[model samples]
Every structure is written in structure tokens, then in C-alpha cells.
Target: MARITIIETGHVPRKYRERHGSFPDMFARMVRAADPQSTFDIVSIPDGDALPDPRQVQAILITGAAAGVYDGLDWIAPLEEFVRTAHANRTPMVGVCFGHQLIAQALGGTVRKSDKGWGIGRHVYQVTPNNGVVAGEQLAVACSHQDQVIEAPGDARTILSSDFTPHAGLLYANGTTLSVQPHPEFDADFAHVCCELREGSAPDAVVATAKASLAEPLDSAKLGAAITRFLTRR
Candidate 1:
């Protein structure tokens, strides 16, 4: 079995947790949906859980969190340190949303809350040619974030981007790390619920547009498959 460690950063709100479960659970299910032979180990580092040795797992994945990399939280620096260690070890690593920004920030890149405001719902990204990281020329995935990786690390190659999110996907030159600003684990239904949950925080118009955009099909499966390929590729 392919062992993957999920470094949990945050939990879904209690209201949403009862239904779709926590973020780590959603990610675990998504990974299994792409490759059933996979097994997972979840470490909630934000809850005082310790980071495991990077050498212990076949691959490591960082999950999305509500927090930003520049938040100055106690755990943020430690997590960045862990990311660097994983990179130095040449261990395969995958990051989603907040994880993506954290990875970039940890590796000499810049991440900041975008002035373009929120990017929610299913956004289409133009895939750049990078062997097979992107399955097609365009990909639509669920997104709910204001912060973004403004400047990708010097050694990182962007595999996907959109007009709204220029540095949407990043692949490090070391060939062991891949990150995306959107969430491939989130299906349209869950994405809708997320939009609804953010109704109070986000603008009503933004939420309405995000809800309306959910009708379009998302290419989450394709992205998941690409992530699996990256984790298990020879």
C-alpha cells in the first residue's frame, strides 16, 4: 500500500463537520477515490500533534486551513520548517490551498492576501505543459480563498493558473513537491455548502455567484488522479 501522511492544519466548522466531516477526512476520501490502494496517517499539527519523520511515509500531503501563512500563528513557523525538511529529504509532497501557500512561503516564495478579493466556487485554470501534472489544457476545481501565492519560489514551475489566480499551481524544480491553490478534494456539493457557510463573512453577491457556479462540472477527479500519479510515479 502507498502510505501517505496528511498534515492537518485546521478543521471544518462544527456545523459542516457533522455532514462532510473534517478537512483531513475529506482529503483522505478524495485520495482513496483516485487510488484505492492508498493508506493514510493523519497528524493534526495544529492541535499539538507532532510531526512525523518524513522518511517514514511514501509521501506527505498538507491540507488546506482557514489560516494564512503570514498569520504569525505559533504553528505556522514549525510547519514551514517541516516543509523544508521534507524538501531537503527529497520526499514526495503535495499541498492544497493553504498548504500550497505555506510551501511557497517556506521555500523562499511570497504569499499574501490578494487584493482581488475572494475567489470561490469552481474556477477554471489554464494548465501549463509539465510532462503530465495537468491532464488537459483547462481544469476546473473548487476554490475558497483570498490569500494566494503571489510569488512562486525561483525553482518552482507553475503548472496551472487562471486570470483570477495567476500562480494557481506550483511544482518545485526538485521534482518532489506539487501544490495547487484550488481544492481537488472538494466536490461541487461540498463546495456549495462551504459557500453557504461563508455567507456571513463573504459578500452576498460573491456567495450567490459561487452558488450559481456550482452547476458546472468540476474536474476534481482529474486533478486527484494527477496527484496520485505524482505520489506514486517512478
Candidate 2:
């Protein structure tokens, strides 16, 4: 069984927490569906939990966060440093959404709130052939973020792309590090609720479209399996 450490940087809303659980919990469920024997250890940065040594971890997954990569939070810098150290050690690592942007910024990439606006709900991405992670032409998954990786790292390859999110998924040259801007851990129910939460913050039309997009089937399970395979592969 592979022991994966999940770095939790955000929290679910109080009302939704009871039904959807925490981000790490969702990820555990998603990963276990693909690898039944996989075990997990969660380190919540927002809860004041210290980061574990990357060299000691079998694999590391950074969860999505409400905070932006350029927010200048006290913990943000340390976490970026952690990502750098972990990548240097060639530790198998995957990052989602905010985690994706964090990893990109930590490397040589640029991240910022895009003028293209928010990308919520179910978004489809064109998968690059022979990516070695996902095996498909297109991948549709949940997304909820305004910030994006404006510029990819020098050594990163665009494994997943869409017109809205050009750098949706990045596979580093290290071969052990990967990051995606979508959330395969989020179920339709949770995704819908996320759209509802954005009603006031996001434009009415965008929220409506996002909520409606959830009516279509999502390929979250497929992506989860791919992520599990990536992390557990020898």
C-alpha cells in the first residue's frame, strides 16, 4: 500500500462541511476508489500543522485553497519552499487548483488572477497524447477558481489544456511532479454547492452557467484513477 501525504490548505464552508467533508477527506475517498489499499496522512496548513519532510513521504498531494498564490500569506512562502525541496528530491507529487498555481509559482512560472474571469463548474480539457498520466482525448472535471497559471514553468509541459485554461495541467521535467487546475476530488453535489456559493461573488450569468454545466457527466473518477496510478507507479 502506498502511503500518501495530503497537504490541506483550505476548508469547506461550515454548512457544506457536514455533507461534503474536508478536502483531504474527499481526496482520500477519490484515491482509495482507484487504489483500495492506499493510505493517507493529512497535514492541514491552515490548521497550523507543520509540513512533513518531503524525503520521508512516499508521495505528496497538495489540495486546493481559497487563498491565491500571490496572497503573501506567512505560510505561503514556506509551502512554496517545501514544494521546491520536494521537487528537487524527486518525490512524487501532485497538486490541484491552488496547489497547481502554487507549484507553478514556486518553480519558474507566473500565476495571477486572470482577466478571462472565473472558471467554475465542469470544464473540458484537451489531453495531450502520450502524457503518461491520463489516457484520453478529453477530460471534463470540476473547477472553481479565478486565479490561473498565466505562464508555465520552463521545464513543465502542458498535458491538459482548454481555451479558458491554457495551462490546466502541467507535467514537470522531473517526471515525478504533476499539477492540474481542476478538482477531480469534488463530486457533483459539492461542485453544485460551490457554484451556489459563488452566486454573490461571481457574475450571475457565470454562476448559472456553472450550475447548469454540472448537469452533464463528469470524468472525475477517471482522473482520480489516473492520479492514483501516477502516485503509486514504480
Candidate 3:
């Protein structure tokens, strides 16, 4: 069995929690779908759970957050340090959305609220050739973020790309770290709700487009399986 520790940096709103579940719950479900024997441990930072030593965990997964990587929250610095420590220890790590940006920023990349506006709903990314982490040539996944990793870390390679999010997925030189700007754990219903939540914050047209995109199929299962494989690979 593969033991994965999930660092929960954010929460699903109270209104949606009952139906959509928390970020860790979503991830656990996704991972279990791919590897039924996989087990999980959730460490919620917002709940004041202290970060764990990276070396002690078999693998680490950082979940998406509503907070930006550069938000300067008290927990941000420590979380970044944790990511750095985990990377240095060569712990197999996977990050999604905010987690992706956080990992990049901690490793000397640039993250900022993009002028390109919010990338909500479903977006397709082209997988770079021979990127061993994710199979196939393209991936369509749910996304909800304004912040982006504009500049990737020096030791990172762009494995997934789209016109909107050029640095959609990054694979670190260390070979044990991987991150993606989209949410593979998000099901279509949850993704639609995420779009609804952006009704006022995002442009009406963008929100509508995002909501419409959800009517189509998403490649979430494919990516989820890939993540599970990455985390459990020997």
C-alpha cells in the first residue's frame, strides 16, 4: 500500500463541503480510484496542524488553496520552507493549483496574480514529449485560480502547457517532485460549483464560458491515475 500525506492548505466552503467534501477528501477519492490500496493522512494547516517532517512520510501531496503563493500569510513562509525541505530530502511530492505555484515559488520561481485573468473551469494542456509523469499528448482538467507560476524554477522543466497557462505542469530536476496548475481531483459537479463561486469575482463572460466547458468530458481520471502512479512509483 502507498501511504500519501496530504497537506491541506485551504478549505471547501461550508455550503459545498457536504457535497464536494474537503480538498484532502477529494484527493483521497481520486487516488483511491486509481489505487484502491492507497492510504492517506491529512495535515490541515488552516486547522493549525503542524507540518510534518518530509522524511517521515512516504510521499507528500499539496492541495489547491484559495490563497495566493505570495499572499504573505504567516503560514505561507513555513509551508514554502516545508516544500523546500521535502524537495531536498527527495520526497516524492505532487502539487495541484496553488500547491503547484507554491512549490515553484519556494524553489526560486516567480508567482503572481496574472493579468490574463482567472483561469476557471476546464482547460486543456499539451503534455510535453517524453514527460514520463503524465501519459498522452494532452490533458483537460478543472482549474480555479488567478495566480500563476509565470516563471518556473531553474531546476524545473515544463511538462504541461497551454496558451493560457504556459507553465501548467512542472517537473523538477530532482526527479521526485511534480506539480500541475489544474485540479485533477475535481469532479464535474464540483468544478461547476467552483465556476458558480466566481460569478461576481470573475468576468461574466469568462464565468459563462467556464461553466459551459464543464458540459464536456474532462480528463481528470487520466491525470489522477498519472498522479497515483507518480506517487507510488519505486
RMSD of 2: 0.6
| Tens digit of per-residue lDDT, candidate 1, span 20-111 | 88888888888888888888889997678998887667799999998989999988998898899999888999999999999999999999
Q: Once superposed on the true structure, which residue ranges of model 2 sit more than 4 Å away at CA?
A: none
Give RMSD to native, each candidate: 1.1, 0.6, 0.6
Off by over 4 Å in 1: none
Q: Which residue pairs clash in candidate 1?
A: none
TM-score winner between candidates 1 and 3: 3
Q: Report model 3's TM-score to 2 decimal places.
A: 0.99
Model 2, 91-207: lDDT tens digits are: 999999999999999998999999989899999999999998999899999999999999999999999999999999999999999999999999999999889988888999999
Cα lDDT for residue 168, model 3? 96
lDDT of 3 at 144: 93
In angstroms, the error of model 2 at 155 is 0.3
Query: What is the Cα-based TM-score of model 1?
Result: 0.96
Q: Rate the local accuracy (lDDT) of all candidates.
A: 0.89, 0.95, 0.95
- As for candidate 2, its clashing pairs are none
Residue range with the least summed lDDT across 10 consecutive positions in model 1: 128-137
